[model samples]
Target: MNATVVYELAGSYFGGTSSRPVPAKLVVADDRLRVIAGDDLLAGPLPLAEIVVSSRLGNTPRMLRFADGASFETAGNATVDRLLAGQGRRHGLVHRLESSLRYVLVGLLVTIAFVWGGVRYGIPALAEATAFALPEAASRQIGEGVLELLDDDLLFPSELTAEEQARLRQRFVPMIAASGLPIRLEFRKAARELGANAFALPSGTVVFTDQLVKLAEHDEELLGVLAHEIGHIDRRHGLRQVLQSSALGLLTMTVTGDVSSVSSLIAAIPAILTQLGYSRDFEYEADDFAAELMANHRIDAAQLGTMLMRLEDALRKCPEVERCADPERGWTTYLSTHPPTTERLQRLTKR
Candidate 1:
């Protein structure tokens, strides 16, 4: 009779049943062992002291013949002597087995949590990598389409002329190329009402609102912003974000495939676009890239720094003008995705 006794575990045999190989940590608990096995308790705390030499099952079943010639099958779940062999509470079957099992389960849960978090942040990176591999022409087309989609009449002026567009391209294209991004530049004829914004699309296109163009005192200031956006492009940050959003859309559409799903995805477009900010590392890389471009072109890195300060100041005074300005906030999901302005300025100054 095998029973798990909570008190003193002395001389008992305890072990689990195995089809092929026997388990190592098998032992018993207490003098008169009371075990809980499955739903039903087993054969006895009966005075089994006469039971001499209890043996556990191995691959081969051997009936032990005692000094008295009495033999019993070791083929059962656990022998009583084995269960009783456990010495103390810490070493007992319940303590050893249950505690080890609990720890194993906990370890599994922690691993799962780590994996989930990595996937959540990693999907965008995966998407970006894929986007970077795309041809420059395809990327530009995507940027153009996004600009058309986002720039409402209130945000973008009516139209830009071919000559003006060429001028903007001339200013931006070489810089983008030098930054190792296969990106094309598109300019809005009239400044966007949205004030001083430039962004990239999945297809290798970057757009600067006319207002953004007018706001820059020097080409380097524009390059600073453009470089940041290019950083987003080179790292495939924007493409990854767009892909992640689209993947979410696909999941929603799979679940509900209705007009509501379409509307929901459309409604989420702004958040999706705005949410695709670069990480601190990416931001720094872009800043350095811009700085190098400026240095090579003999442009002042401090001017880029100045532009940032100006943008920061503008956001503070005209908070209502910018939708995504979190004044003096720290460690935001958004901010975490972007490099800090202070570091960029410091690095530039040091250079």
Candidate 2:
């Protein structure tokens, strides 16, 4: 049943077909019906007419009265279904877009979880394994690097009088021995260059800056500082940090025999040092251990606290003395990397 379609909306009757009734829903979609007939599939030329028409089925019929007294009926149910299918397709597209966004959000959450878990647990285990597998040659290279860095500032050449030097040995040696670590202490007299910094090497070597000795108001201060550095060795903090930072480099070189990336990372060593503040918990643990060492040896923990207080005060007053020795801007290095002074003091005083 092929037919031409015509439209009549209001008082205008458009040329249309009677063979196929134009769908009411399509007509509603576009009301430009002066040319469209109810049966017009091909939107070709059709003469428009003036008419008032109405529908037959529903009470609200599409009514249009033609000038020539003719009329066209409204479209049937099948055309309404076609309009509904078009709407469904649009809704389906929106659903797919929403689904894609959900997947992206889920992927980001998974990535975050994996990274957080890896850092909290996997890194330490990986470092422990790497430490066992590390070769002597590699260890020596690391040791040499540490020694080179410390050599520039370690040892006080001429500042301590002979009696003062002997007294430093007596105070430090017994205290270190009391701490129960298999570590040795050596003093040097390069007083001019290495005044205020101390370090521990990977190969069990501890270097004390001559300036650090000079800054100490008493032996407890020096002992406190040295014990903290020894704690780093005992807990393997230094080894773990180094392994974690170099994990990618080590793994890449191990698998691919590439060294450039590792070398580049090594070259940025100073920047790494500047940023290597210990975790707060690690600092507190070290302080607690040092306090225990002092208590075990019958040395007063308050003396250590007093030493810190004096150092803090002296820093406030004669900043230039420490500043001239070390290039550090202030106590940011000690304060940020260590526990709060008040908290450490409280712990020392606790029964």
Candidate 3:
């Protein structure tokens, strides 16, 4: 005959239908289990494997469930551990992890590293991949109505004469053709509201404010600006900026299985692009592209630097009466969207 090992625990028993529990004792002997109340046998003397045991969670009560829908709840966690040990059963995996300070610190460090890596590298890389994978028609759709929205709210009809506009277009013909993308140039007047600015839309439309055109001393400077905007289109930087800005929202929607909100996000893209502008890295990339384009055309890249410095001076000297209508938007001037003039000048002048 096998040696008998017995253990008992005090707890409460629920008959599976009642809100009230009765005082009960759980008896474990030689791999068999039973629940009793004083003189009454409330539940089975069944095999230990037939009873389900809840994992230990801090000092909370653990529950043992039986096949007949009755359960015994107890706070005798140590005794339950011993009972399980005697039966050669594994238990308290969560409790073992939680009780160790070293494990807690390691978990915290791992969480921090994961969050940092996602924000720093993972999100941007995913945004870039998504931007590139999207079709040209989708890019055009994103940019559609954007210029009209800006025209209705911020920009005005170009005041430059037809002759002058045609002349600039004639000069831009070679550069635009060289780009090998469907590129179009537009001129707008935002003298009082935007001062002098140039921006690119995702659909390969590049807008040059009339103030910017008049501010340039040489055609090379204007071409340089055009090259920069082309860079934005070729690399889909505008779309990438929109994607990166809305990453958290996209992630939340994906996690919750609610992609219906994506349309609302897409609708907000025009506002986000105009208001937030491109990131510093995007600006640097475009500047490098412009410098290389100018070199290929044998135009001095330093002319871009000259134009940038002049634009800065002109914006600063805006007559009090004609100052930008929304100074906070900073979308009013090229300098506002582009990087610091000194940093750009250093790179452009070197080439």
Candidate 4:
């Protein structure tokens, strides 16, 4: 059984201004909307084609717009529902998004989750995959560029007696070379402004600071540090770190037909290393590599753990505030990226 839906008319005063409820009844049928006021037929048997319908999901009134920009409203929505049901076209992806509180909230939550996941997981995985696929020459270029930055601001020629440097290199080189990895061992004197820190470049260059060499109580301890840095190069961790830092910009360029120079990626490495520390897993993996290298060479792996502890103390005493945690001296660990020394020590000494 079909019932006629009659909506009250709030007709405009003086034909087109403010509205006042008139004594009128609006009758809606399958094809048209009709209205009668004081025995006068007001406006149409108007076709649904020239009418636009909009409504909320609940009890709120629906508004209709006529071709001439005049409008009408109905309370209780039942009449609007019937009229919309017969209209050949519908609108309210816009209407539902704006008017339905539940759907709007759900959409907002889903969008946030998607963006968070992309940043946390998707971007890193893509950056790693892309980084690993790059040519070895490109990586070396990146390493050289980073070394250039370090040389410019943080490092100078090593002051170690050549005889001492040659002796250590001769022993360390043969041991590391046996692993079938190509690595260049270079020594430098870190400016007093920096502390004892050793990092591998993507080009397979493992730079040793004279301070780090002097900090090592045993040659084995220095070898342990060298092995750890070799692990970084062997796994291409340096290049990956560089790639990950500038991923969004690099990815944007790749997609937009503006692939630029690898030099730009290299230039950013100094900031990335100083400010953003490597991921914890990379640190652990490098630690594992050093341990394995020590075991293979008949050297005690505990030497690495002992050296890590001392390195922590050395960094603590450093004058650079960005690399240490000294509240009285304005140094904070905010820029420190290395995994906690206690954790690395425990892992290295486990066996």
Model 4, residue 337: distance off in Å is 0.8
Candidate 2, which ten residues in sequence have the lowest lDDT sum?
A: 44-53
Model 4 lDDT on a 0 to 1 scale: 0.72
lDDT for 285 (candidate 1): 65
The parts of candidate 1 lying over 4 Å away from their true place are 1-105, 120-144, 158-169, 173-182, 189-193, 243-281, 319-326, 330-337
What pairs collide in candidate 4? Answer: none
Q: What is the lDDT of residue 32 in candidate 2?
A: 34
- In model 3, where is the ten-residue run with the lowest total lDDT? 324-333
Q: Can you write out model 2's per-residue Cα lDDT over 166-226, one digit (the tens) per residue?
A: 8877778886676565565555554433335556665556666556677777777788777
Give the poorly placed runs of model 4, Cα more than 4 Å off: 1-88, 92-98, 248-278, 319-335
lDDT of each: 0.56, 0.54, 0.81, 0.72
How big is the positional error of residue 251 in model 3, measured in Å on the Cα after superposition? 4.8
Residue 128, model 3: Cα distance from true site in angstroms: 1.7
Total clashing pairs in model 1 = 29
* Candidate 4 vs. true structure, TM-score: 0.65
- What is the number of backbone collisions in each predicted candidate, taken in the order shown? 29, 34, 0, 0
> What would the per-residue lDDT of candidate 3 be over residues 32-102, giving only the tens digit for each residue?
88888999998878888888899887899999988878899999999998887876988667877878899
Q: Pick out the ten consecutive residues of candidate 4 with the lowest summed lDDT.
A: 9-18
